[model samples]
Target: MMDRPVGVIGAGRVGTALGLALVRAGYELVGVNARSEASRQRAADVLPGTPLRDVPTLAKSAGILLLSVTDDAIGSVAAELADGGLLQPGQIVLHVSGACGLAVLAPATEAGAVPLAVHPAMTFPGLPTDADNLAGLAYAVTTRPHDRPLAEELVRDVGGVPVWIADEDRTLYHAALVLGANNLITLLAAAMEALMAAGVPDPGFVLAPLVRASMENALRHGDQALTGPVRRADVGTIEAHLRALRDRAPHLLPAYLDFGLNTARRSRRAALNEAGRLDEVIALLEARSAEARDDIDR
Candidate 1:
């Protein structure tokens, strides 16, 4: 596939970054197709001198097509490209959607394109260094046994290590990634806002070291690194937290109760035994949740 020309079907952040990375890795970028003019300009910026054409034009010109559109659009895009009758046998077509598999590319496969799924386990911001960020990253590669070598080679060409993910587990694997990366961002933003609401002037600066250390420890020690009120089963402290959030940040109460209860549930057996009242914490959370629901119903 590297010997033949490459094209991008979505000029979003991931598409632009992957296109540039492949270009830097010596892949011949023939053309790119994006849904919008702004995305076409982004593609032009990433792959200078490359033409920005329609999907069919790109399909006709390139042997390896990278579909980096949103997950929902991938199937439709594949169907449209296949219906155009531009794909040829032996052509390698891949999508960079973590939540989807080669099934989304069935139309292209029916048109004789060899379908593959390659999802980089990293974020892209449509910048030049976004391509550089691909180095040393892990890519979830899903493909048929005969196409494994092709997938691995493409991953390596862009300085990534390929990890085989079974098609049946793709959605679960992607959900785990979302929980770890995307959900962490949401949690951290909530923490920052909560801190600001509590009068912390620079929440991020104050929280940075603690968050980093906690994450590193959690990664290194698993659940053994659990700490704080939930792990300690400090019912009084947790009750106080619920009260404060209810009075000042009611919008955050549901997430707090849910995550706190989950954390309490996952606390080490030894810690719960030591506290001897973990049930109290669970009860407090459950009662508060029911009360909140009752209030909403009222």
Candidate 2:
């Protein structure tokens, strides 16, 4: 499979990044497909003179077809290609969806194509780091036992660290990735905007290092990594936060509260402002969440 050319059915970010990188990694870009005229145009812009082919055509053209479409579209896209009678025996099909398991490639398998899922655990901000981001980054791989070696080889070929997961639990595994990466971004956006509103000059300068250090600490220590008001259970500060957020950014208030409450519940503490006063912070957060739950049920 490493020696064979590849096909990319969806020329979006992941598709394009992987396709271009594979080309650099010494794999031929045999055939490609992208849904919209806009997307096709975009692909053409990137790989000049590459003709647009249907999904099935893309499948037939390469031994390994990268099903880089969105999660919801993977199954149908695979099915359409399989129905076109394009899959040959011993061929391989793969997808980059974090949550989708081998089942997303069921159609390909039915058509005698081996299915593999290669989900990278890094965010796809843009193309600047696409080729290099997967290098040394953890990638979750789910597939049949027969396909494990091939999948691992492919992961390494593309400069990624491969890890295994069971077929049934892929969805939950994907959820955890979302909670960490996506939620972190959403939380940071809120904090950054808040800093700007509070008239903190050079908000990024003020927040990036602090946030990075906090993340570094948290990753190193797990729940014990918690700090600040929530960890200390500062009821007064929490109350003030509720009032101010409700007044200024109501939409973000719920998200902040929900995450805060969850963090508080996990930390389990209350009533102090000093460093390492997490006991006080945790208590207030837990208490605040409990009060919210009580009101909700009423």
Best by lDDT: 1
Report each candidate's C-alpha RMSD, comma-separated, in the order given: 1.7, 3.7
Q: Residue-wise lDDT of candidate 2 within 1-298, one digit each (tens)? A: 5687798888766767777767767788887788787678757766656677876567667878888788899999889878888889888888988889988788889989889898888787545356666678888999889889898888888787799989998999999988898988888888888777778877889988899999999799888777766766677888899777767765566676788867766665322234345555555556655765675679
lDDT of 2: 0.78
Give the number of colliding residue pairs in candidate 2: 12
Q: Highest TM-score: which candidate?
A: 1
Candidate 1 stretches with Cα past 4 Å from truth are 268-276
lDDT of 1 by residue, 157-248 (tens): 99999999999899999999998989999899988889999999999999999999999998998788888988777788888998899888
Q: Give me candidate 2's TM-score against the actual structure.
A: 0.86
Pairs of residues at least 3 apart in sequence or in different chains that clash in candidate 1: none
Least well predicted 10-residue stretch by lDDT in candidate 2 = 268-277
